[model samples]
Target chain A: MKILILGAGGMIGRKLTAALLRKGDLSGQAIQSMTLADVVKTDAPASAIPLHTVAADLSAPGVAAELIAERPDVVFHLAAIVSGEAEADFEKGYRINLDGTRELFEAVRRVHGADGYRPRVVFTSSVAVFGQPLPPVVPETQVLAPLSSYGTQKAIGELLLADYSRRGFMDGIGIRLPTIVIRPGQPNKAASGFFSGILREPLAGLPATLPVGDDVRHWFASPRRAVEFVLRAAEVDTSGLGVRRTLDMPGLSATVGEAIEALRRAAGDEAVALIRREPDPAVQRIIESWPEAFDPQRARALGFEADASFDEIIRRHLEDEAPATTVRS
Target chain B: MKILILGAGGMIGRKLTAALLRKGDLSGQAIQSMTLADVVKTDAPASAIPLHTVAADLSAPGVAAELIAERPDVVFHLAAIVSGEAEADFEKGYRINLDGTRELFEAVRRVHGADGYRPRVVFTSSVAVFGQPLPPVVPETQVLAPLSSYGTQKAIGELLLADYSRRGFMDGIGIRLPTIVIRPGQPNKAASGFFSGILREPLAGLPATLPVGDDVRHWFASPRRAVEFVLRAAEVDTSGLGVRRTLDMPGLSATVGEAIEALRRAAGDEAVALIRREPDPAVQRIIESWPEAFDPQRARALGFEADASFDEIIRRHLEDEAPATTVRS
Candidate 1:
């Protein structure tokens, strides 16, 4: 099987690329070739398969067509202007997130029309698609009322992906991933960044700020689980999806208190002491508008799994980031 | 108040224009000027105010900017490719419905940036935004899983409207109108056309085909009521809408049997007898996918009313189209 990964330079993208290379196969077919495209060329990982890394701005006029010309069997579209960036620069957000996604779909559609070349297109949506007035546990039937420009762009992409799939232009599946906890990277300015930072920093023997209250809850999955969800989406039988092509990925719903307890259990009280309670009301208010939990029945039924618990999430982060210092209680 | 109607040549657009002209005011402001734009130049109605009719394709570059250059106080965006046409031709549908709507919003945003020129944008969405696996009465929270390309485009437009409104670029309200019954025109090829044709043709003393079973239910409102919904959208207090700017306009839920019975009551059994039973399975299957009813709590609370009953709907058609031959109870 041939594969193309957009945003292959990002943390999850790089992880996914490595995972594919380690496996050297997808959906039981040997990985014959792979192309990784992003705004900046991704580092070429050592691989036996024919691999190409290209720098392409997807929103540029002819960029999508050029990237799609090779036509891989499975296309993993993970590129996006992050929420904070999208909210700050509205035009740039729409250009990269909305127009860029549409251009990619259009390119694939044009190819589909010429020779019925329908590839498995897996799109990465986000839980940000659900917003205020949300239920305590958001149901699968919850209407998409995105509170941010980034959320709106993702919701629109979901709609387009479904429409394109229904029209026989492509075999597509959209997975609305939860807030990925323990994101293995340096801290960022994202409001939800602390969800990862508090755990990631503490595990790495660094201090992290806790902006929201301990009782504050949010949906989550480890980065490893997120990668697994994408792979499942690529290989899952889509006949069951009908026209509603998007699925809310299964995620572990836990409170900040629960996450901290899990962290302390894994890395001892000393590690947990690294958390500084310096509340930022602005971040708290922004976080409050997000969904805390979801009853993602569809994704669960489709066999997509989440981290067993917050404990497992912390353990996985420790194992992935600091293997030598990893401690299990 | 200066007003602009994007699809002034369409049935609802023309009716809305005539209503605005007849009222001589909107939101208690005196009428000043009006601009009517469409792909074809709309017939200029006799008006005392400065009324300008121009032919413009909203999807075309520079067109939306030109239209918004004057910056009307209220803009009624009722333009779209009909569902049947959109389903048959995908590109044209997205171009006219999705891209055109976005362009208009972008134009407003640019103007709003320069001088804070935020106009009350009344966008006409449709119940087609809801599809199968639907509840008996689709509620305000019903997820928009549009089954057709036209519905998809309208749903996207709704998202853009809400996002733009939330950003303070424009004061926007989207009303999801029901299938308009007794549409005053020659029968078109729309799958939902029969919903109007059975009543419209018989009222005109012509035979009409009934392609579905009598029990096949659907949601509807009269064209007059649809116009009223648009007007209400234009004048209503949008502060209550928050970020979820769209409302499902209240509509009477009735079956084909109920409609035929209402026709009997309005124009007597003579009008009902003109109906012919010719079950076209293709049409039946298409109509079956439509929403049967909606629990539009938001629209109801906002004072957007529906026709009292199917009888009232039929009576209104008589009042509007055939006043000379109209018979009361």
Candidate 2:
């Protein structure tokens, strides 16, 4: 099976590529080729398999047509502007997040028109699609009432995915992932970046700021689990999805206080002391608006899973990021 | 009050224009100018108030900017391709329904940037935004799982409306209008057209076909109530709308049997006998996917009203549409 991954330069994208390379196959189909495309050249290890990388923006006219020419059996669309960036820059957000995704879907549909080239499309949506005035535990049936521009873009994406799939343009599945706690690498413009920073920085023996109160809770999953959701989404029989093609990914629900305890258990008091409280109401308000928990029964029925607890989430972060530092925290 | 009405050539648009002209004002402000735009030239009676008509398609590039140049205080966007048309033609659906609405919103936002030209944008959404498997009585919080291309486009429009309102680009209100039963005029391609045709044609001494069973129930509102909802939507204090700006407009729920009974009451047994039962599984499937009823508490709390019962709906239709063709059964 040939595969194409958009946003292949990002953290999750890189990990997904590596996992695909290691498996050498997907859904029992032998791996034949892989095409990685993004706005910038994505780094990948040299392999015997044909691995091609291209730097292109999907929103730019005709660029999507070139990528769709590869006829990859599965296409994983993960490219998007983060919440804070989209919220700040309206035009850019719509250009990239909304227009870009539609361009990709249209490109695939054109390919289908040529010779019935139907590919499995796995789109990465977000919990950001659900906003304030929410239930304690949101179900898969909750409205797509996003409060942020980034969220609105994703919600629009979900609608298009379902429509295109229903029309037989493509076999599409949208996975609304929870916030990825302990996200590796430098902090980006995402409002939820602090969710990872507090734990990641403390584990690395560096200072990090806590912007909200301990009681402010939210949903989360490890980057590894998120990547797995994308892969599993490709293998699932989507005929059962019916009209609603999107599914809410199951995630661990925990408060800041629970994360702190988890960090202390993993790295001891020294590492735990690195987190400092500096209540920024701006960040607090954003965090408070996010969904705290979800009853993702549909995803569970479809076999999607998550980390057992926040302690496991912290441990997975350390195992993935802190190999050479040897902080033990 | 200056009013700009898009899709002014349609049934609702003509009535809305007439209603505004009759009142000579809106929300206590005198009518200064009225700009009516549509794909075709609209016919309007010469009046003392300044009125301008333009032939324009909002999806066309530059047309939206031209319309926004007038900077009307309240813009009523009642334009859209009906459901069956959208389902048959995908590209045209997105171009007109999704892109056109976004283009109009973007133009308004740009005007706001130039001289703080904020307008109250009242959009007409549809109950098509909700699809099966539905709850017994859908609430405001129901998920937007639209089953058709038309519904998807409307759902996307609603999201954009809410986001634009939240960003302070424009004050927007989206009303999810119920099926305008006994819709005044010839039947269109909309699958729900049968809902009105069974009553409209028979009442006029013409035979009409009932495609679905009498047990099939759905929501309804008269054309008069629909126009009122749009007017009230503009006057309501939107400060309480918060995150969710779109609302489910209140409507009466009844089965085809009740509608027939209402027709019998209004026009006697002879009119009811004109109805021919032709069970069309195709249309039956379509009707089955639609929402049966809704607890539109949000719209109700905002003072939006609905027909008291199915009898009232039939009476209103008679009072407005069958005034000239007076047939007392």
Candidate 3:
């Protein structure tokens, strides 16, 4: 199977690439080649299969067409500006997230129209698609009333994916991924960054701030689980999806208190002590509008799994990021 | 008030233009000037107000900027290729419906950024934005799962309108109009044409084909009521809309049987007898996927109204189209 991964330099994208390399096959077919495209040229990972890395701006004319010319069997589209960056710069958000996605779809469509070359296009949507006035457990039927430009762009991408799939231009599946808990990286300034930072920083023996209250909750999954969701989407039977091509992936819903408790279980009370309560009302208000839980019946029925609990999420992060610390735990 | 009508040549656009001209005011402001733009030069209506007609394709570069250069106080954007045509011609549909709408919004945003020139943009969406497995009475929170390309384009437009409004670029209101019954024109090839044909052709003393079973239900409003909804949207207080700027306009829910029965009441058995039952499965399949009814509580609370019954729909058609025959009735 030939695979193409957009945004291949990002954390999840790099993880997904590594997972594919380790498996050596997808959907019962041997891996033959792979193409990794991003805004910057991705580092070439040691691989037996033929690999090509390209720096490309997808929104630029001919970039998508050039990438699609190789005719990969599966296309993993994960490129996007984060919510904070998108909200800060409106034009850049719509340009890259909206227009760039459309251009990729159009490129595939043109190829499909020519020779019936329909590849499975797995798109990464977000939980940001659901906004305020949400139910305790959001159903698959909940209306997409995104409160941010980033969410709107993703919602639009989902719509286009469904339409293109229905028109026989491509086989498309969109997975609305939950926020990745214990994201393997340095701390950033995202409003939801603290969701990961509080756990990630504590595990690394560094202090992290808790901006929201202990009772404040949000949906989450491990970075490893997210890669699994992407792999499942690539090979799953899409016949049942009908015209509604997007699915809300299964995720663990937990409060900040639950997460902190889990952190203590993994790395002891010392690690938990690293969490500092310094409430920032701006971040708290932003997090309040986010979805806390979801009744994602479709994704569950499709056999996509989530981290068993917040403890599992923390355990997996340690095993993946810090093996020496994992031995100590 | 200076007003701009994007689809001035189309049915609802012409009606809206005429209504604005007849009223001589909008939002209690005296009429000053009007611009009518379409693919073909809209025939200049006899008006005491300054009227300018331009043949313009909205999707074309520089066209939207030129249109927004004057910055009309209200913009009634009703231009779109109908569902059937959009379904047949994919590129044309997205080009005109989706890209055109975005270009117009971009034009408005640029102006708003420069001088805070935010206009009240009344965008005409459709119930086609909703599709099958629908609730008996779809509520305001129904997920937008459109079944056709035209519906997809309109849904995308709605998303852009909401996002743009939230950013303070424009004060936009999108109204999802129901299938217009007793449409005053020769029968066209639209799947929903039968909804109007059974009543329109018969009322004009001509035989009309009824392609679906009498029990097949759908949502509807008269063209007159559709015009009223636009007018209301233009002047209504949008503060209550929050970021969800679109409303499903109130419409009467009736079956083909109910419409035929109403025809009998309006123009006597002679008009009802002119209807022919030539069931076309293709048309039936298309109509079956459409929404049957909507609760539309948001539009109701906003004072947007629908025709009381199918009888009233026919009565209005006669009153507006054939005034001389209305006296006979």
Candidate 1 or 2, higher DockQ?
2
Poorest lDDT segment (10 consecutive residues) of candidate 1 chain A:
A320-329
Per-model C-alpha lDDT, please?
Answer: 0.91, 0.90, 0.92
If chain B of candidate 1 is superposed on the true chain B, what is its TM-score? 0.98
Docking class of 1: high
Q: Please, what are the lDDT tens digits per residue for candidate 2 over residues A219-304?
A: 99999899899889989989889889999999999999998988888888887789899999998987888898999888999999
**Predicted candidate 1: interface RMSD?**
0.8
Highest DockQ among the candidates is held by which one?
A: 2
In model 3, the runs with Cα more than 4 Å from the true position are A326-329, B326-329
Question: lDDT of candidate 3?
Answer: 0.92
Please write out the lDDT profile of model 2 over residues B113-196, one tens digit for every residue. 999988999999998888788987997889999988999999999999999999999999999999898798997777888888
Q: Candidate 1's residue-wise lDDT over A162-247, tens digit each?
A: 99999999999999999998887789988999999998898888999999999999999999999999888989999989878999
Q: Is the docking of candidate 2 incorrect, acceptable, medium or high quality?
A: high
In model 1, what is the error at residue A107, expressed in angstroms?
0.3
lDDT of 3 by residue, B1-329 (tens): 88999999999999998999999999999989999999999789899999999998999999999999999999999999989889999999999999999999999999999999999999999988876678888878888889999989999999999999999999999999999988887889888898999988877789999999999999999999999999999999999998789999999999999999998887788988999999899889988888888888888998998899998888888889975563244
Q: What TM-score does candidate 2 reach?
A: 0.97
